[model samples]
Target: MWLTGLLAAAALVLTAPRWLPARVVALRAKVFAKVNGDNAITFPNAQVGPERFQEVYGHPAANGRSRGAALSDLFWYWLSPGAEVHQEHLEAGPRYDDVARTTRALLSGPADELADAAARCAGRVLDELVTGRVTPVRLRDLMVPVWAEYCYELVFGEPCPRAARDLIAGHADDVVTALKCTGLRHPARRERLTRYLARRVAAGDVRRPLPASLSPAERVHYLQGTFFNTAVVQLSEAMAHLLLALAQHPEVADRLRRDPADDRYFAHVLDETLRLYPLFGIAHRITTGEIDLGGGTTFPEGTVLCFSYPDYHAAGHRDPGVFDPDRWARVPARAAHHIPFGVAANRPCPAWRLSPLALRAATAEVLRRFTLHSTVTHTRSLPNRGPCLLVRADGPPPRHLAALGAFLRVRDRWEDVWRSVVQLVLGTVMVLHARRLRLAGRYFETHDTAGCPPGHRPPDHRERAE
Candidate 1:
C-alpha cells in the first residue's frame, strides 16, 4: 500500500506540466527577482501607463545610466570586457560625448551606400548557407555571422577578413549565449577578440578614430565592446525575431517574397515584430534629480525607473498578442505605444536611423533567396534559439510541420523546467560577482569629481533646493 501510494504521487507530479507551466515560469521569474533585488519603479502601473511612457522616459532628470543600482550590476556583468566604457553605460560627460560623435561618424555615409553594403554582405551570407533542401536552422546562429561581417566592413572600410570574422562571431556568440543563460561565459573566447582588436588598433586600421582620451588598451576594449559585441549581438537578435515571425506567417512571407519592392508592407512587418518582441525587456534609468509627476506625486533623486517595453507595446492596442502587421495600417506607428528606438530626448539608440534601413535591406535579401517556415514555440526569451526550416525559393513545400510543432511544445516545456533552474544558479553567481567586483559602483565612488561626476551632468532645481 505504501509503494502504491508512492507510485500514484509520482505519476501525478509528472503530469503537472499540463496545469503548471505558467506557474513554473512565474516562479522562475520570482526566483530571479529575488536573486537580483531591485529598487525601481516599474512602468505600465496605475501610476504610469502607456500615455506617459515618453514623458517620463524623455525627462531630463531621468537620464542616469548606472549608479546606485543592483540590476545594473547584472547588466555590467553580462557586458563585460568594457561595460564601464560602453557608450550605453557611460555617465553623461565629455568622454561619452566623444564616443557618441565617433559612433555617428562610423555609421555616417551616403544612405544608399550603407544600405547597399548591408545587402551585399547579407547576399554573400545567403550564398554560403542556402541549399535546395528544407534544412533546419537556428535563425540567430545564421544572422550573427552576417552582422559580424557587416560591422567589420563599417569599422575597417574593407571586406571582413576570414580570421577577423571568426573571432568576432566567437566573442559575440559567447557573449549573447551567456546573456540568454543558455551557456556560460567563456572568458578565453572574449579575450581572443580583445587581443585581435589590440592588433588592429596598433595597425591603425580603424576607419574612424576613437576618442583621443582613451588609451590604446581602452580603445581596443571600446571597439570590442561596441562594434563587435553590442552591435553584432543586437542586430543578429533583431533579425532572428523578424525572420521567425515571417516563418510563422507564411502569407506574410509569400507577400514579401513575391514582391521584394514592397517597402511599405515590409516596414509594417518590422514595426509589429519590434512591438511583439522588443529587443530590450526593460530599460532602467537612475534618477539624477526629482521628477514631479504633477498631482503632488513625485519620484525623488537616485530612484531607479525600469521601463517595461513589452508591456508598453501591448497597451492601447486591440489583440495585442497577435502578430498582425496590418494593424500598423490603421494606427500610425508614431501614435502607437511603440518606442523601438526609444525617446529622442534620452539616449536613443545610436544606430536608430541606420538600423531600420539595414534591417529592411537584410529582410529583403533573405526573402528574395529563401522562403522561411517554422513551427517552434516563439517567445520573448527565445532560449531554444528559434528552430526553423529554410526552404529554397524554388523548392517544394515541406511536410510534417504539425508533428514538428507538437514535438516542440512538449520539448520546450520540459526544457523550461531545467533551464529555469540553470538560470537561477547562474544568475545568482553572476550577480554576486558583480556586486563584489563593483565595476559600476567603483567608477561612481572613485571617479574624479568636484561636486558630482561631471559624467552625470546638469543638476536641476532639486540640487539647488537641497
Candidate 2:
C-alpha cells in the first residue's frame, strides 16, 4: 500500500505539466464568462490586422459589425467626404517609423527632464485657464496644442514651425487646411518640409529617411496623427477621467495630495480610472491559424477576435463595476495585468513609458494647485470620448484632514494585505486537495500492478515481474 501511494504521488507530479495549461485556460474562460456574460466574443466583418488591432474598441462595432467599417466611415465623414479619391495616396495603415523615432528621443532624454517638461506644460495650461478668465474653457482645445508642441519639439529638437503651430491652433477650417497640405499632391508644402527634414538629417540631428520611405507630405500627416492620437486624444481623455474620478472620490484625492511624490499611489489611481474608462476600450485581433479558446470553442484562421479591457479587468476585479483604487492593493496581480495603453506582448504603443510619465507629472502638478469637484458628461466619440471636466483651482485642504486620509489609506492597505494572505492560503489548500485527489486516482489505477491474486494477475504484468 505504501509503495502504491508513493508511485501515485510520483505519477501525479510527473503529469502535472501536461494538465496545468488546460486547467488555467479553462479557469480564465470561466471567469471571463462570469463577468462579461455569454456574449463576450464577437465576430466583426472588417479585417483589422494585428498592426491595426491595437487601435480598435473592444466592444461590438456599429451596425452590428466590427469597428473597421465604422472607423473608415468616421475618417471620411469627419476628415473628408472625398477620402475615397485620396484612398490610394493614404498609407495602407498607421506607419510606425516616426513613432519609433519620437519614442527613441523621449526614452533617451533624462527622466527628470521629461517630468519637468510635462509639469511645466501643465503649469502653463493651468495658468492660461485661470488667468484667461475663459469661462468653461475647452480643456481639449487647450491641452492639444501644449502636448502637440511638446511632442513636436521632442521629434524635431526644436519648437513647432510657426506656420504649423498657427494652423493647428486655428479654427476647424484651418485644421482641415493643415491636414490637406500634408498630402502627396501638394508639391509646394511637401518640398518645403523635405528641405527642412534634409537639413535636420544633414546636421546629424534626425535619422535618415526622416519620414521612413514616406513622402514628406505623408510623413507630416503621419507624425501629426500619431501625436494627436497619443497626446491630444488619449492623454486628454485620461486626464479628464482622472479629474472626474478625483471629484467623485474625494478620499482618494485627499490621500493623493498628502504624498504627492508617491508614484505608486498615483499609478493605482490612474489604473483604476483607466479600468473604469479605458481610453481604447476594445482591442481587436486576428488568429493566424486554427486556435482553441477553451470550452470547446475553436477559432479558425482569419477570424476577428475582440477583447475588451473593461470586461477583462472588470471580471478579475473585486467589484467589476465600482470605482475602487484600494482594490489594486488587494489584488496586485490584477492591477499589474491592467493594459490601459495596449497589451504588453503585442505591439504596445512605443510611447508607453513616456505617456505614463507625462500623466504622473501632470497629475501631481494639478493636485498641488487645484481641487476638482464635479462630474462629467459622456459624448459619442470614436476611440475615446474624455468627459467634460468642470474644475476650479482652490488652495489645498487642511493638513489635519489630509493626515486622517493618510491613516485611512494605511488601514486600507493593511486590510488588502490581510485579504491577499487569506486568498493565498485558500488557494494553496484547493491546490493541495486537487493534488491529493489526482494522487488517489493514480493509486487506484496502478493497484492491479501493485498487488493481485496469484492467478488473477494479467499475463503482461506477470511477464514483467518474471
Give the candidate number with the greatest lDDT.
Answer: 1
State the C-alpha lDDT per candidate: 0.82, 0.48
In model 2, what is the error at residue 385, expressed in angstroms? 6.7
Candidate 2 global TM-score: 0.56
lDDT of 2 by residue, 106-216 (tens): 445777877777787777767756552112333445456566555656665565664654333332222222222211122343344435544554565642234343444
Clashing pairs in 2: 57-282, 58-282
The most accurate candidate by TM-score is 1
Candidate 2's displacement at residue 167, Å, is 3.4
The C-alpha stretches of model 1 lying farther than 4 A from their native spots are 1-21, 35-38, 399-410, 449-466
TM-score of each: 0.91, 0.56
